[model samples]
Target chain A: MREVAAAERRRRTARLLVHGALAIASAATLFPLVWMLAAAFTPNDLILARPFRLWPEQATLANFAAASEAYPIWRWLWNSLLAAAAVTAGKLALSLPAAYAFARGRHRWRDAAFGFVIVTMAFPTVMVIVPTYLAVVRLGLVDTLPALIVPSIPYIGFYVFFFRQAMKALPPEMFEAASLDGAGFLRQFVDIALPNVAHVVPALAAFAFLGAWNIFLWGQLTLASVENKTLAVGVALFSDIEGAQSSWGPLMAVNSLAILPVLVVFLVARRSIERAFANR
Target chain B: MRGAHGGSLQTAGLVAPAFFAVAVFLYLPIAASGLLAVLDYHPATRAFSYAGLANIEAVWRDPAFRVAAWNTLVYCLVLVPAQVVVPLLLALGLREIAGSRLAPVYYACLFAPTLVSFSVAGAVWLPLLNPINGVLNEMLIAIGLPPSRWHTDARAALWVVCVVTFWKTFGLNLVLWYAALMTIPREQIEAARIDGAGFFRRVRDIDIPLASPTAFFILVTTVFTTLDDIVGIIDVLTGGGPFERTTNLPYLLWQKGLVFFQFGQASVVALVTIAIVALLTFVQFRFVERRVTYA
Candidate 1:
């Protein structure tokens, strides 16, 4: 009876300790974002006030209103959305069949080609920036969306490889059955393979969207006009180029706005996001 | 059987478009960069000369290039360990925490910064570090410390950049380390505990050794990722300013090629940077493969 009581106490203590540790970690992780949100809502004058108040005396939308007026927030958002959509669509359309072939088709050079794709990832992106710029200039694609979209296609080799790896995990019997049913290769992909790999589509799309949206170097170097600038490059323009004073309130407001779409995507696709990392 | 043969050919045909598209758009540009590095090609004059080793030699001799190289080395040296260690420590602390219910909430909080772009991170950090009217300054003043000029001061700028980069990326590393930690067999840990091992001993002797492979993987990838792609942070934060103290090789490539229109020289810098990264990655991979034991 005494031993049983001791065991129960030990179990209870373990549970309590675990709960306490989790609470502290969760708070630490969320602190910066909570602070950002609070600062966003706090009146401008109260933001830098001493002692760092957790809650503002009064909440206001003046920062957001000023942010919109200070920059082309709507235009930047539209540009980002369009570019991200195009890149995601382009990557999927291009990667799907290639992945299918690599996964399902039998060929002598299959492994070699796949290996080539992986090896290319080792090439530092910075090394190719200058040459790519030259190519874009030669193709008259500077300042155009195609310049952004086209360069991204080759970089999707990793994505294609990931998809192929995922597809390889599916049973091969399905392909054989499809072939027996008079379905050709294209038909089989449409019917059997697509359905099997559907779960990975959203995850891949999220990866591509985040990648294309946050592309700052390519956009900054390639796009010359403010009209063509994406949200990242636009927000960067707020920095004082020549020791001019910068507006902290409007800058933070714009920064917060710029991250909203990605934040929304992450929240909505939380499962897929977790799965992508989990699988990796 | 006849359909199978035909199906294979059709599949290959279906895949050709993508392969070709990537070759033209991705591989072709990379190849062109290599070719351009050796030739003296001025965009303005449309002139081309076989400069051979001249551009490479210039990059080697330039003091500014050397500074950029040193800055990159220092940044990577400091960041790789911090990124790995902080996340690993957090994951360790997380394991002791119960209530699997809070796991998702914690993950969401930790992983939040990964979704946000580097540009946004730089912007947010800028105001917080501002000398005047900045929260950091206000906090320092309250604590009886002097204000810091953060991005403006040459000495402080690199550290500020490092902190911002860490904030933007540490979450991703946390997830990776956490997943790796999960893969450690519960039985082994329980056995170690039953043998009278303490918490730190179990972690240091058992858990870390088991997680070494994952840690190594993160290290190599982080080096490449940060070295290759951190130009965005430089552009947004310091613009490699206050005397170009923060100009790493990538930004230097941009400065030469775009800012100065010295395409030939920039290509040289890019080539050298790629060569260095590839060499280091290869060496690190080979070294880690011998030491890392996979469960």
Candidate 2:
């Protein structure tokens, strides 16, 4: 009985130690972001002053006003929303049907086609980006929203693979029952396959939205005009123009704006995202 | 049989749009990169002339290419293992607190930075890393330690870049690791403990093997993202500067092709980068795939 109590005490100690360490690590990991948040609301002079303030002396809206005045912050935010939404929709539209085909439809060359799509997952966008940019230039699509959205959609290899796996796990009998009800292929896909895999949509949507919204290099190259830039690209531009000066306040403010929508999206979808990744 | 035939046709129709777009944007560009590497295009004449092995030879001899190649290797070597091991450790710790209220807080905090774009991450770090009015330096001064340039120092630039990149992106791997860890049945570990297997032995003999599939997935994705995502951070933070200390092959490709308009040389760099990724992937599948337990 004494030995068991000793072991229990040891286990509790270990648990406390582990939890304590994790808490410290979490604080350190979040410090940069927390600092950015604090700086965004702090006055610029206090930010650049020595013995740096961890929290703002007085929170102010001046930084946001200043950031918007300096750049088309609102316009960039709109562009980011448009580009991310369009790209996410395009990916879902194309990949859902294709994944349905791969998972349910009978075809001789289905695996071959799936292989063809999945192989591109290995091809980094940077590898093909040069030629893609040149193609955009040739088509007179540079600096346009399509240039950002259209090419972004085709990198759906991971999405298709994921959705196909999700769809394949559905019982074959479910689809057979739908077919017995005289449902056509398109009808079965739209009504049965898609609805069954709807749990995955939020997860894939979060991934696609984050991927598209966080587009920096492509947006930088494609969207040349300041007015056309996404929030991701605009933040970079704000930093560059502001340079290594005392404008950390406005820069952090812009940075906050860039991350706000995505953070909200991620937090809202966190549970489904957790489930989706856990299963896959 | 006739209905099955019609289903196949419909399948083809369903797959065609995605296939076509991927071909044009992804596969076609990949193929065109190869073609453009060998053929010289003149803007003046709007004509292409075969350049033979000139582009390949040029990139091979270029000093910038050599540095970029080395830096790329350094990145992969450092990032791939760190991303794999660190996250697995965190995931194990997280599993211990699975049912507790603190679990969500840990997940939310760790995963927060990963959701932020690379550009914003870079922007956030810029002020903190600034040598002169930066918070980092101010802290150092307060502690009676000499302040140092973070990304500004040539020797430290690559490491700084790596640290920031790791900070920004490691959460994805952490999530993947956590997910993989959850799949391990409790009975197996309890059984092992009953069988007198120590902690290290249990982890080595069971947990590691069970998690190998996610480990392999994490390894491949980490390398790819390290190549693609670092460019934005590099652009915003150092611009691959402090004397080109942080320029990897992808950044080199961007610089050569887009910045310098040397499309031929950039194509060569691009092909080399692709070859490196392909080779690493092949190696992983050949060697690591065998050990990955499907469940």
Candidate 3:
């Protein structure tokens, strides 16, 4: 009985250690973000004068106003939203059909076609930048939101792979039953496969939005005008224009605006997104 | 038989858009880049001239390209293994508290930084690493140590970039590792325990084998992103340098093309970077594929 109690004690100690270590690691990992939040709320002078504090002595909305006045932050935020939404819809529209075809449609080169799309995943996105930029320039799409959105959607290798996997897991009999009912490939896809795999769509949508919202270098390279810039690209430029002095608060406020929407989206889709990665 | 027969046109219709878009945007660029590497294109003048091997040869012999190549290696070496191992270990630890109340808290906190863009991440860290009244230095001074220059110093710049990039990127791997860990049959670990296997032994004998595919996946993705994602971070944090100490091949590609508009030099850098990527990926398949097969 004493020995069993000792074993329980040892296990409890191990669990405590694990929890403690994780807490510290998580805090360290979150330090920069936490600092950004704190600095965002504090007044500009205090931000420059004092060291990092978890909570400001007094919080203010002045920085948000300043960030907006200094740059077209609201415009940038809208541009970010428009770009992210378009890219997400484009990814879903393009990939869903392709993935469904790969999963269910009949073609001799079906696998090869899927391979053709999926192999692009290995092409490090930067490798294609110079040429993609030239294509955009030649097509007169630069300095436009479409410059960011249209080229961005072709990165659907993972989306196709993911949705394809989700569709493959469906009951094949459903498709056959639809086929027997004279529902063609389109009907079977729309009525059967899409409905069945609806659960995974939001998770992919969340990822797509987050991915597009965070587009940086491409946004910088293409959206050269101030108002045309997305929030991700704007924040970097904001810091450059503001420098690190009395503007730390506004700098961080803009950073917060860039991050908070994604945080809310992550929270909303947390369970489904967790399930998505956990399963595959 | 149902799987074998469908209207060819319908199937083609379903697949054609993504097929064409990817081909045009993704594959066409490689060809474009190949041509651009050999022929000079002046953006201002809109003139193209055949330069033959001059661009490639110049890039091959350039000291800056050599430096960037070396730095890229440094990033891959430091980050690839660290990304895989740190996250795996954390996932292993988190398994102890998997569904506990604090589990989601830890997940959120660790993942919070990832939701932010790399530029925002760099912005967030900029103030913290600020040489003047920065928190890091303030804490150092509190402990009676001098506040060191963070990313501004060429010697410290690369490590600073690596840390920021690691912090920004590791959350995805951690999540992957956690997911992989969850799928391991609990009974196997329990069986090992009944057989007197310790934790490390079980991780080696069961968990590693079970999680090897995810580990392998993480390894390959980490390798790719280590060379790719740091560009934004480097751009925001150090702008690739006090003396280009932190610039990698991707940054070099950006500088050569967009910044300087040397289309030929930029295309050469792009091609060379892609070649390196292809080589690394091939090496991973040759050596790592054997280990990833246990799944």
Candidate 3: where are CA atoms >4 Å away? B1-5
lDDT, candidate 3, at B164: 91
Measured against the true structure, the TM-scores of the candidates, in listed sequence, are: 0.91, 0.97, 0.97
Model 1 achieves a DockQ score of 0.53
What pairs collide in candidate 3? none
The CA lDDT of each predicted structure is 0.76, 0.87, 0.87
**Global Cα lDDT for candidate 2:** 0.87
- Model with the higher lDDT, candidate 1 or 2: 2
Candidate 2 local Cα displacement, residue B272, angstroms: 0.4
Per-residue lDDT over A92-170 for candidate 1, one digit per residue giving the tens place of the 0 to 100 score: 9888888887887766666676776656656666767777887788878899877876776567666787788787888
DockQ of 3: 0.72
For residues A1-280, write the lDDT of model 3, one tens digit per residue: 9977987898899999999999999999888887888878889888777866888658898889999999999999999999999999999999999998898788889889999999887888887899899888888998999999999999899899999999898887888778888787788888988988887788889989998998888898999999999999998788777554458888889998998788887778887887787775
How close to the true structure is residue A98 of candidate 1, measured as C-alpha lDDT? 81
lDDT of 2 by residue, A208-254 (tens): 99999988878878999999999999988888887655699999998
lDDT of 2 by residue, B137-206 (tens): 8888889999989999999999999999999999999999888888889999989977889767988998
